[model samples]
Target: MHWESRHERAPAVTVLAVGAYTVDFYIFGDRLPSVGETVAATGTASAHGGKAANVAVAAARLGGRARFIGAVGGDQEGAEALATLTRDGVDVSACPRTDPPTARSFICLDSRGQQYIMTWAGAADGLTADVAAAGAALLRPGAVLVLQGEIPVAVSAAAAAAAVPGVTVVLNPSPVEPFTQPRSDPDAARLLARADLVVLNAAECRRLIGERAGSTPSGLSAEAAQLRRQIRTATVVVTVGAQGALVIREGSEMHVPAPEVKVVDTTGAGDGFVGALAAGIAAGMPLAEAVLLACRAAAVSVTRQFCIPSYPRASELSHAPLSPRQC
Candidate 1:
């Protein structure tokens, strides 16, 4: 399956990211500070780091017509985040300004590229409305609706409901709250059921399925298939850092290998993967091929520091031959 041929044959599908927005402050140090102990940082940087915003920026940079539907604070930080998205070619016309200040995150990265993050939801939680409204206004047939767990469950649920018939929904259940929380998330469960595809990591897969995942090839495939049924989605993708990403469609499973690269920072790598995956789907690449592109994009992102700043544009990604391992 040639990428150019597939992309050329199908019409371009729009990508809409509807979720959270935050300004992240990163502190780089030789090592992460232990709990109750303060450690000095070697360097600090601030950037846009919300999952939804990252996805929008990533999709746009990868050549997708991407739009963002979320709220930002009426502050300089919020202003910068919106500007960053704009410069990255993400449509922010539907993003509204809210009060109580923008969201913020503090990330501490070690020399080995390991990181620990703490976030404050801030104004991201105060929005009176707009997520569903903007999503409804922009989403239509042939469009891709992207959602994440950073936003309120109600917000995600509303946006999912607003999606026009024929629109494809992609959910990335990051943070794994829906599966980790003691209380059941009906909204999240329903959203998962409605999604055409769901992307998560290995740990998230375990949490969702309420057990340990299979480590062996056959074990992974079996667990992934079980996870798909549990989530009630037609397709599910579980990303395994370094090893690659797994794609499970209905009952079949395939593994797409990650490109070898130096790791400067792991921040936003998953977002890059999700964004690139969504963009590839919008461009008409087959699921397995799209996962391949996504893995390549993620590999490129980890080679640099920061979140959105480290993302690679479509031209920056070297095309790798698609060779997905089957389960």
Candidate 2:
């Protein structure tokens, strides 16, 4: 079954991201600073960031009609974030306002593209479940609603609950909570139950479905079944860095390997994949084909640096819809 009516080149569909919004402070150095020790930085910069915000920016840049629904502060940082999203062609009208001093993240990037990020939750906490529901109500048929773990689980649940029947819910359970266990977090369970497609890294998937002895650890058939039993998701994709994404569905699994490229920064690569996947879904591509496109886009992202700056636009993907080997 397909999600939407496929066209030669489907028109853009709305991709709404409901989560946190923040500003990022990047400190680039030859190596990460040791505990309580200062290291000389090669360079420094600031930009708009946050899981949901990055996904929104990525979708818009990839030719999707993306919209961001989250809270921001009344400070200049918040204002700048809004302006940047606007410039990126993401709709910010549904975003709520909270106290001054928006959320912030301090990221330390090493020359090898590895990073250590420290975050400060500011006005992002003001984004409530009610606010998320209001934003989710804007979604229509064929729309894609993106959710992340950056916000409260209850808030994500509310957004998922409020999504229209035809809307495709994509959940990225980052920073995995103890929410997929026997005594799982109810709100988290609720959110997952509503997700049509669930995307997470290999580590997150292992954490989600408790690792067992002699297990593949990734989204192998057994682990995928455990995840499916936990949440009735139609498709669950476990991303392995460089190995591409492992797509698991009813009795079938396929590994989509990524094209090797020079690695610059691993930061925001997953966000780029999610954004590209959502855009492909909105454009009516098959799930496997969409995952392939996402893999390609993520490969492009890691060839650059930073978060939102690393996302690739639609034009950069030329011939993104490559035919998939039968899954």
Candidate 3:
């Protein structure tokens, strides 16, 4: 669906990111350690991560007013996560601190900047539908609700259901299995129905399409078409890293190609795309234009290292003229 003008104007477009937060430990080496073996690394570092947290920070960096809703622990990691998001100008007032320790991820990046990650849910698992709905309550008509699969599926569904009509719900089911798996729960079925837009990588699109269509799609274009039909109401965006993204909406498709950039780290690149996409929508950019900018943002992200730190600012994107658009 297109962005129709609301009857009355709102102060500013807000982006509410609902999901997980974690402290990411990055171990950099020439190559990943072998099974049951230890390898020396060239370097290492730690930063704030988690799909939702990375998205929020990316949006904030891209000049969008962002709000974060998720659970953190009463630990040092939690404190650091809050501080990091706050420093980036994201609103975290609605996020609650729980008894469980904060979630954490250990990432190993090779010289090529490809990442392998392991996570501990900690307090993130404590995110309930009630907490997510509470955060959704803060959204007004012109707001955007960003959801991810890192937290409970119920919580994400709750946030989507609670959003107002004029508010856009963007779902990025990263670690995509939870929602794509066969759902016995009815609410799980409605998750895609409630989303205004759904972002998926190649593999995610394949699984979702395979499950919904009862057969594997023949190819990328076919998968996009089938997925569009399945999620009839919401726009479907299939992101093909490096090559660009395919946007399928209302029987029409747009291929938004990303500019070529030197790759550094692909970690959180999808989050960067979703964040910028939400930011663009919140800023009143047309959906097609938003996807274009989002693709550019993601391309820029991979040229850097780490997660949130790798996201490019809006100004950075503006400085370099983007490559041509392929429809």
Candidate 4:
């Protein structure tokens, strides 16, 4: 089937997400306990996590046809992950099952809304090239393909490349360790070149490119510029939590400041931003407008706790506050 026809049959915006699906255990309240130290958590909850799954939920919540492509273990957590994705309106028809147990993350949120997380790759690491190939037909032209660091680098790269000449691949290189150079993996530079849009946090951008001139308050324009110089992709977005986001496209740049909110947890704010951005892009919004929409979505995400559960749907986002057209 032709790519466009597939999208037409679905919805106005279709997103093919390739990455991991993890179950997250969130411990809400103050700081994490020290060794042998006991602390009472104000609340505890479990929800779906993993970069791709979060982004898939973000896209779906924002009124897009979001399809997740990854592997889950045959374990109970995997089943829960699948159920969570389905509940979020994500199409899991392309997801597979394995025997390695599903990926999972343990996240702790402090009173300040900062989070510390540890994750186990589990079945996520087993996502191979063959699996991605099986879902290649789902890459509809003009659709958005959201990728991240949760999957194998080769698999992520192949999915990104395959989207070319078909879907628009938006890569969020999270965790940032997989792309480290002189390392035991494929060349990240080559894979990045194939991405239609690259999204990362301030630290990830600095890791990919060296430190550049810019203070925390002025935003990471200098570092963002350096990354733009190093990357071949047309768009590079550097997400700075609370401070907002920066976008560099075709020699032009735009900064979208984040709206102030009572942050409860920031675990999935970045994913929400990327998902919203992809949704806007898939909906044919200009990069600048898309960045603004994404900024709004992310701002809303921080107001709630956890990852996937915190993401706002399109209707909620429509009512959220947005930054004015000034950086």
RMSD of each: 4.8, 4.0, 4.4, 5.2
Each candidate: how many clashes? Answer: 0, 0, 0, 0
Write candidate 1's Cα lDDT for 1-327 as tens digits: 122223223223378888778888988999998989998889888877888888988888878878887788999887887888888778888777887799988899999999999888887776433555455555656567898888777777778887776677888987777545423777777788778888988878777777754455447667778888877788888898898998888546788999888899999999999998888776667778789989989999999988888888877875422111110
Instruction: List model 3 lDDT by residue over 1-327, tens digit each.
Output: 456443244534378899999888999998887789899989889877899998898888877778888899999888988998999888888788999999989999998877789888899988889888877876777677899888878888888888777788898867777766535656656777888888988788888766553443346777877877776656888898888998877768888999988888888899999998887777667788889899999999999888889988877887332111110
TM-score-better candidate, 3 vs 4: 3
CA deviation > 4 Å runs, candidate 2: 4-13, 33-40, 178-184, 212-221, 319-327
Candidate whose TM-score is highest: 3
Model 3 score (lDDT): 0.81
TM-score, candidate number 1: 0.89
Q: Candidate 4: what lDDT?
A: 0.78
3 Cα displacement, candidate 2 (Å): 3.3
Tally clashes: model 1. 0
Locate the minimum summed-lDDT window of 10 residues in model 2. Answer: 318-327
Among all windows of 10 consecutive residues in model 4, the one with the lowest summed lDDT is 318-327
Off by over 4 Å in 3: 4-8, 11-13, 33-40, 211-218, 319-327
